[model samples]
Target: MNQAVRSEPGPVRQTRFSFGNPPRGSVAVVDTIEGIECCSEAIEDLAENAVHPNPFYEPWCFLPLLGASDRKRRLRLLLVHGTNDDGSGAHDTLIGFFPFEQKLLHPLCPVHCLCPWRDSYRWTLRRTPLLRSGAVANALATLGRWLVAERHAPKILVLDDLPGGSGIIDGVERWRAEDRRLCHVPDMHESHLYRRQTDAEAYFSRVLSGKRRRHLKRLRRLLEDLGPVRVADVDESEDIDRLLNEFIALESSQWKGKIGTSMASMPNGSEIAKAILKEAHRRKRLSLLTLRVGDRLVAARSAFLAHPGCFGFKMAYDEDPVYARCGPGFLLDQEGIVRLHDDGDLLGKDIEWLDSCAVEAAALPLSMRTEPLPLHRYVVAVRGGVSEIVSRRFHRVMQALPWRIRRMSAF
Candidate 1:
C-alpha cells in the first residue's frame, strides 16, 4: 500500500475529519488543483482497484478539466484512507476518491448542499466515486462519519446520475440502515447499455426486429447507391489534434452550432477537449470510429476505454438534408457494434460492454440494439436540520407531480 502524500510546492494544509478516534480508516480533504495533482499516483492506484470503473473520474480525463480556465465551481476531493491492522499508526492505503462541490440546491431554494462535481462544459456523465474493491462499505462509512463530524458540512448530500447497481448505492444503503437518522429519497431512470454476449451478427439478430433490420439494410443500400460507404477506425498513430479538430468541426456544423451549444462555441471548450483526448490517447484509453461515404466523413463516434468496459462519450453526424435519409448515425452505431465484437485490436477482446452515456430520451433510438440500464439520483440528509426538512418536502412535492412537471422543477 502506497502512502498517500501531498508533495506540491507551498504550504499544504491537510484537514482530518472523523468521529471520536479513527477506527479502521480516516478522511482527508484536498480543495486545490495542486493538492489533487500531488495525489495522482495514489488516485491512479485506487482507480485500478476501484469497485467499478468510471473513465470520467480517471486522472487522464479529470485533471485537464480542473485546469480549464473557464471552470466556474470550486471542486474539493474527499480522500478516504484505510489504516493498517498493525498497532503502528499509518494510514497508508488509498481506499476511495470522491470529488464534489458545495452549492445551493437551487436558486429559489435556500438549502445549501453537496453534490458530485460537474464541469461547466458538462462532460462528466458518471458520478460514482472510485472505491477500492472489498472496502466499499468501510469507505462509505468513513465518508459518512466524516461528513457528520465536519463542522460546516452541508445538511444534504445529493448524488446524481449514478449507474444502477453501483457499489456506491449498496454501501450507502448499508450505511443508512446502520444510521437510521439519515433520510434518503432515490429516483431511477433508464439509460442505454450494450453488452457483447455473442458475435455481432447473432447479437443484432436477437435484439433487432426483422422489420427494423430490413429498414436498416435499405438505409445502407441508399447510402451505397450514393457512393462507396465504409466504416473505419481512426488509426492510433494519427495525430490527436487533427482528429479532434475534424470531430469538433463536424459537430459544430449541426444543430448544436445553430443553438450556440456546440463544443466550439463554449468558452475554452475546444482546448479542454483536446487536452482530455490527448491524455486519453497517451494512456491508450481512446477509441474513435467514423462512417464515410466515398471521400466525405458523415458520422463519427468517440469512446473512452476502461478495462472490461467502454463508455461512448461523444458522437457527431452530418446533418445535411442530403444524408438525413441514409441514417448515417445509426449506420455508424451498427458498425461500432460490429467492431466491438469483431475488431479485437481496436476495442480489445476483454471489453464486455459499452455504456451509451446518454439519457433515456436521447438513447431511445438505440433501445432495440442495446439493453436498458437504470440510473439513479439520491438526496440524503447528511445531518438533520431546517435544510433537510425543506429538501425532503420539496422532493415529496416533486414526486407527486406529473413526470414532465417534475422534470421541469428538478433540482
Candidate 2:
C-alpha cells in the first residue's frame, strides 16, 4: 500500500491520505472528492457519531460490495466530502466510483466516474452538501494534475454534475456539447452540455386538454364515491423503500406476459431501483419522488430535480382492474407534477420543466419531452480491442434510436 498524507500547515487536527494503490490489489485508495483520505476512514467517524441513517456511500456500506472487486482493475472510486471535516470528516468524503470497464469504444474518450450519483438529470458533486465543498475541489484538481504529470492520459474525466471547482485542473479539456456540461481531457470529440427549456405547463397542458385528464379527474371524483377522494404526495427518506416496492409491483405488472421487456420483467432491477433511491435520498437530492392515492399505493415516480430542470426516472402505478381506465399511472404523474410546483413554491426554488430523459410523446402530451445528456465517449490505444469495438457499436445504435424508446428504457 502507498500512502500520500496531506495536512494543513498550522492546525494538525486533520490530515488526508490515499491509503493504497488500487492497481496493486492488496489495498486500493478510494477517490475522495475533497481529495482527502478514502471514504473507509471518513465513514468510520460518521457511523460512530451521527444519529442519522447511513448514507448510501457510507464506507462500511460500499466497501464490502467493492472490496472483493478491487483486484479486478475495473474498480474506480470517487469520494464526496461531507461538512464534518476540519474540512475533514464524513461530509468531507465525496464521490466514489468504479468503472464497469476501463476503455472507451468510440472515437471519443470514455472516462466516467464508476460510482456516480445523479443530480438534476445529469450527475454533479452537490448531490449532497458535503460534496459541494472547496476541499473536494482541491482534491480533484490535485488528482488531475498528478494524473497529467504521470501521463495517465485519461481521455475524459466525467464528474457527474461537475460538482464545483472542476475548471482548475490542468491538461484536462472541458466540453459542453450535449444536454449538460462535462470536464475532461480532450479526445476526438470534445464534451458538451445539454441545455433545453422545460415548459411544464406547455408539456402537461395537453394532458389537461383532452378527456384523458378530465377522465382521470372524473375517476378521482368517482373514487371519492368509494371514500374521500384524495391525492397524496410523498417525499421522505424513510418512505423510500416501501414506495420502491410499490413501484416494482406496478412495473412487474406492466411487463407481465409481455414479449420483450418491462420494468418488472428484469432481474435484480428492483434492487437497483432501491439502491438508487436510497443513495439519492441519502444525499437529500431531488431525484426521489412518489405519489400515492388513498390507502393503496397508486403511483410511484423517481425523478431528478435540478435548479432549472428535472429528469424523470421510473414511474409506475399499482394495477387495479377496477381503476385501469382511470389511468392511475398518468393521473399520479399529473398530481406529482402539481406537487412539484407546490414544493418549488415552498422551497423558494425555480421549478424548471421536468425532463422525460427521453421524449415520450405520451408524456409530451402530459408536458415532458426528450432531452439527451451530452456524452463524450473516449477510446484509447490501451483499452482492449473487443471492448472498444463493442462500445462504439453500442453508442452508434443508441444515437440512432428515437427519444421515446430511449425514455422508456432502463439503462
Query: Which is the leading candidate under TM-score?
Result: 1
Candidate 1, residue 376: CA error in Å? 2.0
Candidate 2: list runs displaced more than 4 Å.
1-37, 40-73, 78-101, 104-148, 151-228, 235-244, 256-294, 304-311, 319-322, 343-366, 369-411
Structural similarity to truth (TM-score) of each candidate = 0.90, 0.49
CA lDDT of each candidate?
A: 0.76, 0.40
TM for candidate 2 is 0.49
Q: Which ten-residue region of model 1 has the weakest summed lDDT? A: 83-92
Deviation in angstroms for 75 in model 2?
1.5
The per-prediction CA RMSD against the true structure, in angstroms, equals 3.5, 10.4
- Give model 1's clash tally: 0
lDDT of 2 by residue, 145-176 (tens): 33333233342333322212222221123212
For candidate 1, write residues 1-411 as lDDT tens digits. Answer: 112445548545456654435457778787777778888889998899887889888888888877763445655578888742242334558888888777777555666777888666778877778888778777777777776667677867776766778776787787778866667777777778888867888878877888988998999999999899877776667876878898989988998889987888888888878788777888888888888888788998889988778888888999988887888898888887787787456775688888888877884336444678787877777546686686668777766767876654424
Give the Cα RMSD of candidate 2.
10.4
